[model samples]
Target: MQEIKLTDVRYRPKYHIAAKSGWLNDPNGLVYFKGYYHVFFQHYPYDAVWGPMHWGHVRSKDLIHWETLPIALAPDQEDGCFSGSAIEYDGKLFLIYTAHYNLKEDGSKSYQEQNLAVSEDGINFTKYQGNPVIKPPLANNTENFRDPKIWSDGQDFYCIIGGQTLDNRGQVLLYKSHDIYHWTFEKVLATSKVSTVQGTMWECPDYFEINGQKVLVVSPQGIEPDGEFYQNHHENGYFVGQEKEGNFIYPQNSFRELDRGHDFYAAQTLLAPDGRRILIAWLDMWEQKYHEQADGWAGMLSFPREITIEDGAVRMRPIRELGKIRRETLLNESTAQGQYTFSSPCVEVQFKAMQDLAFEFTRGFEKLSISYQNGKFLLEKTGYKQRKITWKMETLDVQILSDASSIEIFIENGPVISERFYGEGDLELKFQSTKDVAVKTYRLEL
Candidate 1:
């Protein structure tokens, strides 16, 4: 290996495409426009850390091969382009983002206003003449207003804006538009005061229908710990509900956390042209430790998932097509009702660890769980403090869930946790350790 120097922040010498030189967070606008997948993100191109935000671009006929384009947006047009949503209207792709105009001296207190942009070629976007289409509500109760997630319902366009109250409570504001522009205030669907010290402000709000049920996804910031709620970034997940005439009725008293791992957050969904509900999440935990930020790019999006309801919870895992990238089968086998072991990353396997070994397995580590039977204990690691996070992570992601093709875990070998990092092979599942040990491995051949 040779030491490479000076350029922009990039994802090593491999093929993982990142936007520009700086920080890239939530996937802003992800839609299958025309026949290609147009994925936009929240990017900051000048540095490795977060600063002025812009909308980055990438398009792929197939999700695997991506072509990076010029920055779709920059603070040059606005002070700070906060996160928002994008949609296609009348054969044109339109973006609705939060333009944060900070006026500390003017005493406006850094408020966010919604702005619009239109793109005909799906590449170059033009700002709307009537910029800042909608200003923040005049109500004295709101604060930190931003993140407009707009979607279409029949012929009408509906949007949900994330915001906070003067008292620091999180709320999502709803609006209705008969014609893309001229949005009318609908109502405040829900209000959640996350914690004692932390004020909750909704980040990104999304509404969709799943299996005859309505689901509401939200990103809430400034949250305090209250048992299950406010877990990751105060939490980014959805609720399965019923909506009639625009009002949502969530009989379920709580929200579900999409990914149990430390990496996935700020998830946004899209109904692909085929009508399948697919989702993508920001695979970077907010304020997380054990991160290798020095590697330049800090965040990556989760593998696409097919969202579904299971036992009143929103269950998400990698979509089936994602596994097609499995160029070679490194390991493959079925164990004869037995106990097994796999405490590593580079290696792969295709057999269960057994009831006793799996800790009473129910589908082998679905996002987040704790089930270890007999002697084989399985824990899905979500990063902890002090000692190497890999030690704990190996107990779950590697030790338990590595048997499936729905996951593609990126590894940085460490001599400290040799049990998890085998080598840099990018190997596929080769053999299955039934009553014995069988494994396979693979690498993303760019």
Candidate 2:
């Protein structure tokens, strides 16, 4: 690949967390430690395409502005360092990740084992001397084990690792640890056998609690398409349920997709000091062409979102800290319905529609449309898959965050659609509605 400067990247995001260069995927090792919010990701720095994995590091005092750090973990003894989580234990930040190795040339067989790394100041890290802290569980044929999400209940530390049975059924394994090193297998928390839509392999598993309710999130593979759902090669979703004596108990039909978008996967969360559950996820999908690869970078992360449970369903909203990036208000609660222009591509548009409404964002000939009619929300752009959601409410509240190359659409009390687009020059926004719609627009600066 020819060397290219990231500053010239046309589709690079302004506020989202993307690698300075090269390839980036799954957000890993998310934790709040030492007064900084740390985010680690699976990266390959040499090129835009995926290669041997390394842990790329970034830190922020707040979730909006981030500072890139050095590479945390590389493929030293293992073929690659896969996804995992982080925790602050004993005044040190601990990273529990999977060391992946390929046993066969055809990629038919592989080995995965959990390892540990420690950081004293939450910047530089050192791998544990006695690595491979946890191996595959011996209870069943679980060779496809990886992505450990760890947490503490104020007592023993608990972990949930994604795995698949020998029969190719996706499952999550539970484990417990007291000292953060040694761990013992507890049980199989849940499996694909409970529901037909559950995929064959689970890649990432996250377990947390909100408002006295337990939620299990995972990235599952091999799920077939169902109408407008499961169109992506993989899916990220969660199950709301209860835990009983180390086992997760949820209804078979309780699983719901976390984000209804064309490019969303591998979501992880961190508990903020202010008692908020904030989440971030990869803004790219598998088997999709990434336009930014030509500019020496590939993937980015979604903006930090606060997760909450309302009406027995998970609701996600952009964090309040995002307000710090607002530069100037272009339109404040305006009811006009005509062409609005912005000098830069980074902007935010909020609106409330009581009737059918349509909004189009254009840059030259390229256009992206967001419309709501007859209780349906639709997002469409050229050369991209269409995302639609069924909404039952009479009034619709919408939030649109646009960066240089990405757009995140948040529907109040509904689903969110995040996607990537390639456009240049200034932005032209046109709004159309039968009745007056209250709109607010702001210019966002990084």
Candidate 3:
């Protein structure tokens, strides 16, 4: 494999957390420790394609501007370090990750085990000498268990990992640890036997409580499409319910999609200083076209979002610190149906429709159309994908972040739709409606 330099990636996002010069996936080990936010990701630096994995590190003070640190973990005799979570324990930061090893390199004999690494200063890290704290659940099948998310209730440390059974059904495995080095398997909380909404395998699992509700967030693979749902190759959604008697209780109807987007997956959440549950995910999907790989880099992390549950649904709002990147206001006024141009490709736009309206965003032949009518919102792009949602509010608010090669749209602080657009040249915004609409646009600093 030939090496590609970072300078070659023309589509590298300015404000997004991207690999310095290679393929990146799955935002792992997200935590806030000692007044700074740290993020580790699945990285391969030899080329702009997936290879033996390493843990890439970055830190941010305000969640807006980030500084890249060194590679935290690299594969030894094992295959690679896969996705996992981070927890701060007794003034030290501990990372719990999946060790994917293949004995023959062809995966004929492969195993995924849970391991640990610790850091005192949050910069340098050392692998635990007594590693592989948790072995695979099944001795005969070792390929399905991975992605350990750890948290605590102040008495004991708890971790829930995503896995699959021998019959090919997704399950979340629970474990307890008194010390960071030792762990014992407790039980299986939920499985495909409990609900068919769970697919053949669950990749990343996260459990948290908000608004008096316990939410199980997981990325399930091998789900067949139903109507407009699960139309993507895979799904990243949540099940809203409660925990009882060392088990989870979720009705099949309670499962809901988290983000209706084209390029969002492997989401991981962190509890912030102010007690907010914030999330960040890989902004690109697995099967999506990677035109930028030819330029060097391949993926980036989505902007940090704050999550809340309302009316049995999960809602996500962009973190307030993102305002720090607003450099200048480009547009702020009522406008009728017409075409307009913003100052730059990198911008933030907010819109509120006085009445039903349709807004179109375009660059060259690529276009993204958003509209509201008869209490429904729709997002469509030609020859790509479409998403629809029901909205009962009198006024519909839409917030959008447009970069050189990507766009993220937030619908009234709840459901979001993100996509990657490789169109070259300036952006054009147009509206088609009889009623007036208020629009605010800002130029981003980076």
* Model number with the top lDDT: 2
lDDT of 3 by residue, 41-79 (tens): 999988888989999999999898899999999888578
Better of 1 and 3 by TM-score: 3
- Cα lDDT tens digits for candidate 2, 233-316: 799999999988867898875678999888899999999999999999999899888888888889999999999999878999
Residue lDDT tens for model 1, 131-230: 8787899894464788898899778998888878777777778888999988988998766634333336767788887778778887766655564334
Q: What does the lDDT read for residue 29 in candidate 2?
A: 93
**Per-model TM values vs. the true structure:** 0.78, 0.96, 0.95
Q: Which pairs clash in the backbone of model 3?
A: none
TM-score, candidate 3, is: 0.95
Model 1 residue 390 CA deviation in Å: 21
lDDT of 3: 0.84
Instruction: Specify the highest-TM-score model's number.
Output: 2
Name the Cα RMSD for model 3: 2.1
Q: Total backbone clashes of model 3?
A: 0
